[model samples]
Target chain A: QQQVKQSPQSLIVQKGGISIINCAYENTAFDYFPWYQQFPGKGPALLIAIRPDVSEKKEGRFTISFNKSAKQFSLHIMDSQPGDSATYFCAARVYTGTASKLTFGTGTRLQVTL
Target chain B: SAVISQKPSRDICQRGTSLTIQCQVDSQVTMMFWYRQQPGQSLTLIATANQGSEATYESGFVIDKFPISRPNLTFSTLTVSNMSPEDSSIYLCSVASGTNSYEQYFGPGTRLTVT
Candidate 1:
């Protein structure tokens, strides 16, 4: 089963416009929600992360709005740029003992056109 | 955050052969994970490697197929044995970092294409 589900397999936005990607989870045990940005041929890097205690967290132009009760979260990129064109994955971390594992969403491929 | 590097960014191997991908972290870590990302699929955990312990593999993965080695806290290697065309995927190594192990950092990944 896909524990985390992401919407809009691909998206396109004009430069200076806002880009949004959404994800929903089924597991309530998830506490840490993080967004990762991956460029072709490279690894996914942490873009922004939010704990369940916070409803929202923002880093630079990237923002993560999380709703614990709804089991949903979304990523908003303000003034999206061409460089922002990449694959974005939303992940939830479930801790077991001393280790934590991430369950990733299917990912959204965003393209920002100038 | 830790700086992670993987050797042989990509390789194409023949069927039935094997390839060993190495992961190196800049600092010591208690947990390291190996993941496989197939085309159009989410990253799946292959195994978790801890220093001085046998790797813990997730379901559908066997230690005999994907043997992991964590000889020390800063280094680990994953060997994909008896490769097949279905084994063509991107293999990534990640380390648990940050306070409370709240963050995980990933290596660049090794793209393996089994022909």
Candidate 2:
């Protein structure tokens, strides 16, 4: 079962515009949500993350808006640049025990055009 | 953050041939993980390599098909046995670091193309 589901398999946005990717998770026990960015021929890197206690977290131009009640979260890139064009994945993990594993979404390929 | 280097970067193997991918980390870590990214799919965890014990594999993965070896804390190798067209994918290794949290750092993946 895919615990996390992401929408819009691909996206294209112009420079200086807002690029948003949404994700929904089914596991209520999941308390940690993280977004990863990947370029071709490279592995995914942790871009930003948030916990259940926060409604939103921002790191420079990258912002993660999380809704605890809805079990949904989103990543928004402000003033999107062409360099940000890549594949993005959202993941959820439950901190219940020592062997917690990550459940990942299908993925969203974003293209920020200049 | 931990820096990881994976060898070969990529390879194309013939049917019935096997390829071994190596992952080296700069610092010693307690755990190392292997993941596979199939075409048009997200990354899936294949197994977790422990320094002193047998590796723990996830569902749909077997030790015979994908053998793993962790000789020490900083290095590990994954071998894909009996290459098949369906085995083509990107293989990645990751290690968790700092404050003992779930934040993981990954190496540039090795692309495997089986013919």
Candidate 3:
């Protein structure tokens, strides 16, 4: 079963426009939600993350809007740029025993066109 | 964030052969993990490597097929035995760091192509 589901497998946005990607999870045990950006041939890098305590967390132009009640979250990129073109993955970490394992979404390929 | 590096950035091996990928972290960490990303697929956790203990593998993975060694906090190795074409994928090692520490930092990844 896919614990987390992401929408819009691929997205295209114009430079300076807003880019949004949505995700929903079924596991309430997930307390940590993180978004990762991955470039081709490279590993995924942590972009932004938020806990269930906060409804929104913003860092520069990247913002993560989370809804604890709905079990949903979305990533909004302000003023999207060509450099932002990459694959984004939404992940949730569930603590198991002494360690935590991260479950990732299918991923969204975003393209910013100038 | 922690700096992580993987040796043998990429390799091409024949079937039935084995390859060992090494991961090195700049700082010592308690929790380290190994993941595999197949062609056009998301990252899948293979095992958790902790120092001074047996590695804990996720379902669908076994120790004999993918042996892991975490001799110290700063380093670990993953060996893929009897590799086949289906084993061709990118192997990544990550370390948990930072204040939250649940967030993981990953290596560049070792791209393996088995024929």
Candidate 4:
């Protein structure tokens, strides 16, 4: 049913510029939102995450802006670099009593070019 | 963060073959999961491997096709049985930082190709 929807299947931004990816989710049971970065031939790594209680969270150059009422969130990379070129996925977590499961977005492939 | 590793980093199999992938964690964890990523696609959760019990699979996934075994807290195995070309994908294993934490970590991944 595509609980989480992401926009811009692909993106290109110049190095040192800002790169942004947007995501919207439908399930309110999703209490945690996390962004994962993946490189080719590798596993997805957790980049940053935020809770529904927080409007924003920043980890170094990576920032996550969340809107509780809208059920939307976005990831912004300040000073995007060629090293940051990778696929980004937005995921929502819902606790199922004993464990948590994540529903992922389609993904956004970002390319930071010089 | 827990360090996770998967065996048989990649494999190529013929149709009707079965491939088993192993996942090992450095520390004990209560919750472990299996995920699949098709070519150029996002990750999809296959099931949750519970220690000492049968795995809990998500919708669209079943035990007969993707059987999972969590014999202990730090290890699990996923077997893709009677494979087909459509089964080609990268299988990944992940674990929560801890039961009380919200963070989850992933292993490198097992790339499988069925011809």
In angstroms, the error of model 3 at A1 is 5.5
TM-score of 1: 0.97
What lDDT does candidate 4 reach at residue A69? Answer: 94
Docking class of 3: medium
Compare the candidates by lDDT and give the number of the best one. 4
- The TM-score obtained by model 2 is 0.95
lDDT of each: 0.92, 0.90, 0.92, 0.94
Tens-place lDDT digits, model 3, residues B1-115: 8899998999999999999999999998988999999866789999998888899999999999999999998999999999999999999999985323678888999999998
True contacts kept of 4: 0.60
lDDT of model 1 at position B55:
91
- Pairs that collide in candidate 2 are none
Pitting candidate 1 against candidate 4, the one with the higher DockQ is 4
lDDT tens digits, residues A34-108, model 4?
Answer: 999999999999999999999999999999999999989999999999999999999999887878888999999
Better of 1 and 2 by DockQ: 1
> Scoring model 1 with DockQ, what do you get?
0.64
What does the lDDT come to for candidate 1? 0.92
What CAPRI-style quality would you assign to candidate 1? medium
| Candidate 2 error regions (>4 Å) | B98-100
